[model samples]
Target: MGRWEPDARGRLRAAAIELFSERGFDQTTVADIAERAGVTERTFFRHFADKREVLFEGSQVLQATVIEAIASAEPGTPPIETVAAAMQAGAGLLQGNRDYSRLRATAIAANPSLHERELLKLGRLAAAAAEALRDRGVAEPAASLAAQTGVTLFSVGFEKWLTDGAVDDFALHIRESLAELKALTGDA
Candidate 1:
């Protein structure tokens, strides 16, 4: 409302989520999101590539967080442990964003195209993670397996955190998911 407003991207994102929840992702347009945020369509476009981009803008940052964590992990740490640490590191990005995350997840779940896009983003993240693991000198199958498995566990943890509403700690859920994975694979 002032000349010095902060977080225009956040405002646009919040408005987009609200509009999508009320009108459905397919029904919501970039113009609608901009109006709701009290910004112009140009402002919306400046922040997001399109309406769908609002929901996925954080994916790139999240992937970078995971990859950096993997790359910086101790030299001899097991691949899975490195992944769990990476998941934990990535979790910080979404911390205290539970409500926005829940709304985004709901919108993604209700749309087939959005769901496919989400899967593609996750796949890319997994690929990046695998490449990071290889940089750590992990062998082929082990690196690939650990990366995919980490993505799966991270996905499950995020779902639980977003949907439960009562869960206050996203990282804890991720760590718990990793523990379960380790237990299942007898790596615990």
Candidate 2:
């Protein structure tokens, strides 16, 4: 790895995760990540705001993907179903990155601050989804309920996807979780 490498961003992300895993998130610093990635602190800053940002850089993209799916869903689709489909679409971003996802999850789970940050990220995603639903003419409580449920479904499904080594389809896990939710609500 070199400072001139084409995937400096990718290298920085990988290095950050690696360092976070080995040193723990609290122990790892931007300088450590930059050194591990063979880049300057300036290069690392160019890629991310801070070490924590490396773990959350994809959040905006994930939210955007979910919002787009919700906006594009067929007219007359149920709110829950639309949000579920949107979450599934968002899951696509994590496909083929299971190993990294698992490592990232581990790192986040180990640190209280990281866990709080993760929760905040999920909250933002849900809020954005709710707004998208409102844009699609979904009513207030229904939009918020569907968006919150969808975010919960996504969280459950993502955990299952990460822990179940044999399963690779994130959407399937989400569908299964949604089914379970429906069963609980007598909607199954």
* Candidate no. 1 TM-score: 0.94
What are the clash counts of all predictions, listed in order?
0, 0
Q: Estimated TM-score per prediction?
A: 0.94, 0.95
Off by over 4 Å in 2: 1-3
Which ten contiguous residues of candidate 2 have the minimum total lDDT?
1-10
Clashing pairs in 2: none
Q: What's model 2's overall lDDT?
A: 0.93
Q: Write one digit per residue (lDDT tens) for candidate 1, span 125-150.
A: 99999999999899999999999988
Report how far residue 91 has shifted in candidate 2, in Å.
0.2
* Residue 93 local lDDT, model 1: 96
lDDT for 125 in candidate 2 is 96
lDDT of each: 0.89, 0.93
